[model samples]
Target: MKPIFPAIRLRDKGNWLAGRDGIVMAFFIHRDHSEVGPAIWRSIQAYLRAIPPGSLNWYTSADGDMVPLDDEGWEHNRHVVIERIGGGSRTVELRESPSEAGSYQVEYYGRRLDSPFHDAPATTLSFTFPTEYLVEHGAVRLRSLALELARELPLNFGYASFALVSTQGSWASADWDITEALLARYAGLDAPRAMRLSSDLGTRALAPAWLTFLGQPLLGQLGGIDALRDALPFPEVSLLPMDGDRVLVTLDEWPDPIDTRTKPIPPQYRALAQRMEPFLFQYEGEALLPYQQDMNRWIRRFL
Candidate 1:
């Protein structure tokens, strides 16, 4: 069978990379780094174990240069992750070579609880996996991994969905045209802003994705899982109760990169968006560029 989304690589002009299908899973933890750091580490370990050995061959160093994930470099990166998790603000990034498409990637941003810079503080952990892994191992395996990670972390809001992953931020990259075009064509392809959302998301939820994880006060605010189920009555939607008073809402059997150019947004996604509208986070600033305007519009696609 043909893949839903074929792998894409534009190494010369844009240095872009995307797999046949891409999965972007992110969690926002309202707790301070000191409290959630260990959990974050464990989640990272879980991710590493899930992927092939040596899949991650590079990591971003303190100087922002990509360094080989050699023994010494790996140990140093580990120290940085643990040390930053223990005390101050932290940003940990590990990934395969940017030259390769369908590479495994992990990005984490941990903020200090008492930092004056962040009005809405939350630690954000994001993971990117090529859907080839899912196709080979099965969707159930990925779902189980997501559940395990969610169970371990104290997250306020989290989501897993099909996305267009690139080496750089999609909004600010030179290949914004390609990114924008793909996003316009595919309603299910998410443009994740983990770094931006970490500082602003706080306890609020973003738009719903393929798999939406609701925890704590957010779930309570929505009147719990029962209310959600009642609101989203589509047969394609499933609400699974999780540990820590969290719930994982699955939108469909597999993520659909619905071609919006030819079809309407999936009803299940639209319904969940409407149900979560009151609590969804909207982009606040004025969009100065066409790409920015497109992003803001995408944020409100379901509304």
Candidate 2:
């Protein structure tokens, strides 16, 4: 069956990795997880669930021991490599190690199983893989479909921000940043647009609104909104006034008529909303601080 959406299977040997490890196995489609549309999410979910259990292997280091793993456990511990193609015919490999600087390598793959891209093999892809594995695997590559899947999922094991970022050091704000970047790249807007959409502020009102908005009744007294807003990607505050606070934003103007906003609410969104609705009462009318519970709720909502 010509799969609905493309997906890549990630496996590890020697070090355990997977969803639980803050590594995403692959980016599949779901209503709430992506703006990519339901059809795409269904295709991706099918591709992943249909992965014939045990088709992939996982490795992990436990107590100075490298052990093989089963599907469930492996999926929880392995780090997934999100593939991306950047410049024409080029693939960029990203792996990071806190012990050292990240290894950024770009190369071309013509005809090989490890080679994932198929567009004349001349396109550039940017992707994230665990340095712990890459150091052992020694320079891995992916295909075009794999890259696209990675970009779509845009998160590694629910840990690292998958798009335009190399590490998960900022896992706290990964989701928001990823969403903003995706919107900016596809919709043509920067941080300002993200803020406006989430905060309901206008261009001229952005400044004063920002001051008061940041001090929202809920988020102000706790001094949490500033941190949250700072975590987002926005145009420089200094540049906002000169530009009339005209932040860049993208609207789909493609002539191809691909309706990204196709209707029919998704189950994932419903499920997520349900999951988050309960949390609103957890704090009992207090400002929604950025606690793990708050983060979890937002993550549920965003995904």
Among the numbered candidates, top TM-score falls to 1
Model 2 Cα shift for residue 122 (angstroms): 45
Every candidate's CA RMSD: 2.7, 20.8
The per-residue C-alpha lDDT of model 2 at residue 267 equals 31
Tens-place lDDT per residue, model 2, 1-303, is 110111111222322221111112222111121122332333333333423344223232333233444554333332221122222111111222322212221111112212233311111112233323322332112222233343333111111121122222222233544433343332111112111111111111111111111112222222343333343333322111111111211111110111124433223323323322322212223555566344333333322
User: Residue 168, candidate 2: how far off, in angstroms?
Assistant: 4.4
The number of residue pairs in model 1 that clash at the backbone is 0
Model 1, span 49-89: residue lDDT tens: 98899888887788888888788876776666567424567
Error of 1 at 181 (Å): 1.5
Q: How many steric clashes between backbone atoms does each model show?
A: 0, 42
